[model samples]
Target chain A: MSTPVLDVQGLAFAYPDGHQALYGVNLHVHRGERVALLGPNGAGKTTLVLHLNGILDAGAGSVAVSGLPVTKDNLREIRRRVGIVFQDPDDQLFMPTVRDDVAFGPANLGIRGGELEKRVMEALDKVGMADYADRPPHHLSFGQRRRVAVATVLVMEPEILVLDEPSSNLDPASRRELAEILTGLDVTLLMVTHDLPYAFELCPRSVVLSDGVVVADGPTYDVLTDDALMAAHRLELPFGFDPRAIGRR
Target chain B: MGQGHGHKLHFHGHSPVHRAAPHHKLLALLGFTLVVVATPKDWFAAYGLYLLLLAAVVVVSTVPPTYLLKRLVVEVPFVVFALLMPFIATGPRVEVLGVSLSEHGLLAGWALLAKGTLGVLASLTLAATTEPRDLLLGLERLRLPQQLVQIMGFMIRYVDVVGDEMRRMRIARESRGFTARNPKHWPVVARSAGALFIRSYERGERVHLAMVSRGYTGSLRQGSDR
Candidate 1:
């Protein structure tokens, strides 16, 4: 109601080869709210996420973060506000040591010396990866690397934390741990996921994107319970995993 | 992928050499190699002294002699070239052990072996003591171009990722009962290589996007991020 943290209005995008990824789409996420962007493969989920950070310019509409439009001039401030945790941890953690990787974003902002160190450690501490500050990312376990990836973004203190497939390769325990971490965070969250159970547990609100359009936007419980909508959009819950039986957390 | 402590060439140690600043060691390595290269080939005594100096450093560095010796296998091709120098090189002849050999050729061959061995040994000692990251930082401190440093940093970071991807591709190929047993299978291997290149290129683009999303402009700031 009072200036949503992320405002996407009529956002649309198409690849260079004439493949239209997103049609006109409108969504708004308020401060401190967690929202899941749910869609099947090629439903323009990634296209929408890219737009949020100005990685891909909008074909038709505009995306603004916390009232600041994502444009060339506002890119630095916009990037600072919108932190995207990519699906593959390997893609995000590109520095030699965990400390360096975590410090990369802040360092880019000209943060130096003790301030940078403190920020890096604080982020690592939040993810319980404080001990691995000096360790090479390649030496870390897959889940640990994922946690480190989150720290790399968290160090920036973004307003809206955009996670792309956060639970894709995580084991059950890792998934639960990440959920705990994500739930504890105090930032607006936009999770792009096909993990229905995860969405039900983490995000209070869910938006279903089908054919580059928002087909459904409602409470997570309502979205998951709509059998016809789920069937039509190819959104399937795991066998015997009933949302009504377990209910929302 | 499960490399625990240090890089393959690095021996985890806490000796004075390991504690020494990386750029200093880099300069020392350069100085030592230059001195060795500049010495006259006939100066056999000077060569021995250089070896002694290298041996002392190796001892001080606490890297085992056998470790250095084991890695010297990389110089085998050079060693073979040095060994053939006396036979093919034309020079004044001298008989030793009933075999005639060119005197200049023998000296040239000796110099090549001595210089090559000393250089290789010194480099191995440096590598054995210093971590790869430290060495790169040392290069940065030595005023290497920032872009080149960043490229090297990224290469070090993603080499394993690319390697793992290749390994997975190989496994996928093997699972499908494909093997490059002969020249007939070269095309398959070439195609796989092409696929890897394209995948790596796409990954590079994604990594660039990720960097952009995190506020990376044209150049990374020179700070503690190194």
Candidate 2:
């Protein structure tokens, strides 16, 4: 009903070597909606996500965040609105300490002094990483690093929190904790993942991309249960993950 | 990633030296080193004074004496070089214990050993008191080249990541019965190094894109997140 927070239309892209990564892909994410962009490796999921914040320009079409067209002129604004949590927490939390990593985005945007400190603390607190603020990121466990990565983006106060393969390397407990943190946030979410169970658990809507195009789009449970569609896209749920039996937590 | 924080020289504590601003301590250390270097070699008492000054700092900082001794291992090569000087130089000879040695050589070696040891100890003390990140920040504040500082920052941040990758590769190699005990096994090590380089490069690209997405427009602003 509300204006979409993210709008991508006919987006197509190809690397310089002529490998087409995305082909006329279209997607829309409404305000506060959590959508999982599910696909196999090299299925252009990352390329599509890159296009969301203008990191990779649309080769043929357009991507607009909060109705602002993603272009050189609007890039700063668009980036401010779309916070991307990269796949590697090491990459995302490049700053020395957890607090600095959390403050990096907002500080780059010129937030300073008490307000900057407050944002850093609040972001760390949101991820339950306040106690680790002063610690070097390398000192933390992998799961802790991932949580700090999430806080790094959260400090920017972006409308849409885009996560890349968030559940890939986490232990079960960390995975559950991360899910709880993510679900508690009141923002639009676009998670790119190959983790079928993670997609089903976190996102109500799912868009399946295959060979650079959307092959399926609907409720996650429905898309996941469609065996032929899942097979066609090379999506496989774990042997015991039956979508029909698990109620939304 | 599996290892400890792993900064061997840095001993974390809340002593006055540890609490001092990094740039201030960096400046102080530089000034002290200059004073030591400028002191004439014949001024043995001045050297003793310098040693006493350093000892005072060490005592005040509460850095364990044994810790400093452990860190001194890094200066072993220099010590060896200095030791060679007393035997190798050609000059007027002197006999102390019936072994003839050059008087100039002896003085030169003494000066080198004293100055070098003092300098290394001062450095170790500075390192012990300051966090590595703060040291980088101190360098940036002291007008070190921005590009060099950025490179250093990236190296400090990702050294562990690269180390972890290498560990994984090594495990993967060893699990497959690749025992690198001889020269013939070097090719495998070299290949793994090459692979690590390529992986690191790709990861660099990904990190850059991640930075771009979060509005990193070239220059990095020092965050007041402390």
Candidate 3:
């Protein structure tokens, strides 16, 4: 098989206060694959996502994006390859205008002038926010702001698009709209979400993290259908929403 | 979600003043205020001319006089100070309408009111015409320190976020039947304030991490190459 776009091997980390967030964890995502990282609260989902982009250094093991290790020296290139869209769009869209926010990542790489404008517009266009390039992020609807947040990372053209709780705050229409957009994208996806239905619809495979360890890794259908496994990990589907009834996309 | 309008101070218009470059307007505001401040307090005619000039600019800018007047309530404290100047200041005495007054004090008071009013009016005009984003760009063009500029940039971007968070906190408090109507409730308010500060600090840390994830090294590279 071709090299996995994202490779995490035995990755572990503890906070400065000695709260161990992640134990030894191993995962691999190949090119153009969508994998959901499912876990309950404090299961080290955010800790693992932070490690993927060097925001948090690993205590042991390694994380590599397309064969490039995430390190101080390779941070710039690594960040370019691994784009993490935070759960709250407010945290990500910090620039004064949508155009500036979208251009921020590429501009940091020294992209300028017409090239920067083109990249910004293209990303906005992809998210159907082309008309809002000049709007302040605060003026946007919550869902629009979320889409703009996605564009901010997309402008960088990352190899692996890491989304942290992409559907947390969206209404049903916005959720469906975002799902459509995500399904159409070509990049590798690593989504950390508790939205079981979202995981079923978007990601074919799922990894269940419990007590900072990967307890289950298999098809989304298999993971969601395992009643005992779901019960043990506190991973519950919305009441009466059956994965078998909906089936795989 | 309803708070999507641009800055409240800004009035949308296509007047020539609005079309003028922000840096140019900033410099003009500075020049006008300095000239007003430097003029002798006794030069009542010069002050009137300055007012006329400002009034003309206001007319050109197309911002309503009532809009400017309503916001001028911010100047009430200064007005009180100016009004008290004549009564408290020691100077040569004079009688006007059978009331004792100091001649120099009257002039000083007049000067204070005139200068303060002119400065406030001019600033309002500038703010009413230029968008907040453009004002930041104008400051950048004026060679303001990049760090300060970035601070203001972040403040503009996150002010709404902080405000929304505060609103939610207030709603949560109200839902729990908490209200600070007197000094007895001070501690609750203070604790809420403390919580907000900590939350904002944590948010700052998260924002920094987000910046780092996007390749922000130390200083922002925006406008450096442009």
Candidate 4:
């Protein structure tokens, strides 16, 4: 890919309590590529994902999205290029109504009048939530809330989609729908997930993190199906699932 | 989250008062308060007129009298406090109901009761008709502090979240050996409260981060996109 869409080099973070969540993490994501970050809990996958949108600043190095360095001055531009869906849809959808939440991002971008309304409608349509534009977030089912959360981010028209545990609480049918939706999108995808089958089915490439460091980076099938590596790093594939056949989609 | 049991400040339904322009209803409430207070202590005719107006507005709003009366219970403390004004005040004595009471204090108490009830009913009727958001919008439009209204809007939205969280925490504590039987163990409950505060603070930080990522500048938008 000509000039990676996202570039992270030696990024590190330390909480005030002196806990190092990320340590010199370096990764590159190409334009329009769907990649998954697979690791056990506390692997710093979420910390890495937060860096993509400048939610948590990197201490050791830098993160650049769309060739723009992520910084306070350039946050608007960087955020416009990186759409992140949090692990909890409850945290993501906070507005009284779905339409307001979907409109929230576009409004922040200073999009006003009819163009903004059009953007909100188009976004709801993208996630198949047109009928629920006025429904309150709390009234929605978990699956529907997830879709509304997607709409909330999509309205910004971000180039890269970074999701943390998108399939964490979704049913099988919702997962299938999410897979289809992700597959149809031409934008870049960086998903942090512990769901092995989910990661394999949705992502072409995979990266593994363990003990605050990158342990494996390669094709999804190679990284996910390696029994020895899986055991060593606390990763596993579900019974009777073949990663090779997953790519047929 | 289920069955909508806790929302007190919500639009009752479609009604002329509910459909009235937010600005108009806001002005009317202000005017009503002004008129109600301007009336003298013994202008029973005017006081009666004001009460009639309140009833009319309540009926127009379609909010049940029971709902309004139920909420009006919030003023009982104030009413009781007003009821004490005549008894406690040292003034010209009068014999009534076999007990001497202050005549001046009684008139003052009547004024207090009249104004307070009218003021409260005006507010209750307004709240019943207009949603909290529209009321804030009305306040903003009426030149109230934008920062304050924005803060109120956010607080109204998230206060429920905070309550839900507290409820869940209380449930968890009850499940895990928490009890009020021992007054000395109250410190345990206090510690849980502190933990809840920390969790809420952390959640706020996370929410702010999410808002920044989504490009939230300062205000909450409803009508126009920006």
lDDT of each: 0.90, 0.89, 0.90, 0.83
Q: Which ten residues in a row have the lowest lDDT in candidate 2 chain A?
A: A240-249
Residue A149 accuracy (lDDT) in model 3: 91
- The deviation in Å at residue B71 for candidate 1 is 0.9
Each candidate's interface RMSD: 2.4, 1.9, 1.9, 2.4
Model 4 misplaced stretches (Cα beyond 4 Å): A171-173, A236-249, B3-6, B34-40, B93-96, B99-105, B177-189
What lDDT score goes with residue A21 in model 4?
86
Q: How good is model 4 by TM-score?
A: 0.89
Better of 2 and 3 by lDDT: 3
Candidate 1 at B72: error in angstroms?
1.0
lDDT of 2 by residue, B1-226 (tens): 5766657678989999999988999999999999999988899999999999999999999999889988888889988988887789997899979988888888988998999999999999999999888898898899988778878888888988898899999999999999799999999999999999999999998888878877888877444334
lDDT (Cα, tens digit) per residue for candidate 4, span A1-249 = 477888988888987788898888788899888999989988888888888887787878999886899999998888899999887777777776788888888888888888988999998888888999877777777888888888889889998889889998899999889888878877899989988888888888999988778889888888977879999998877778877665544
Report the number of the highest-DockQ candidate: 3
CAPRI class assigned to model 2: medium
Query: What's the DockQ for every one of the candidates?
Result: 0.59, 0.61, 0.67, 0.45
Candidate 1 chain B: worst-modelled 10 consecutive residues by lDDT: B217-226
Q: Is candidate 1 or candidate 4 better by lDDT?
A: 1
Structural similarity to truth (TM-score) of each candidate = 0.95, 0.93, 0.95, 0.89
Candidate 2 residues lying further than 4 Å off, grouped into runs, are: A247-249, B91-104, B223-226
- Range of the 10 consecutive residues with the lowest summed lDDT in candidate 2 chain B: B217-226
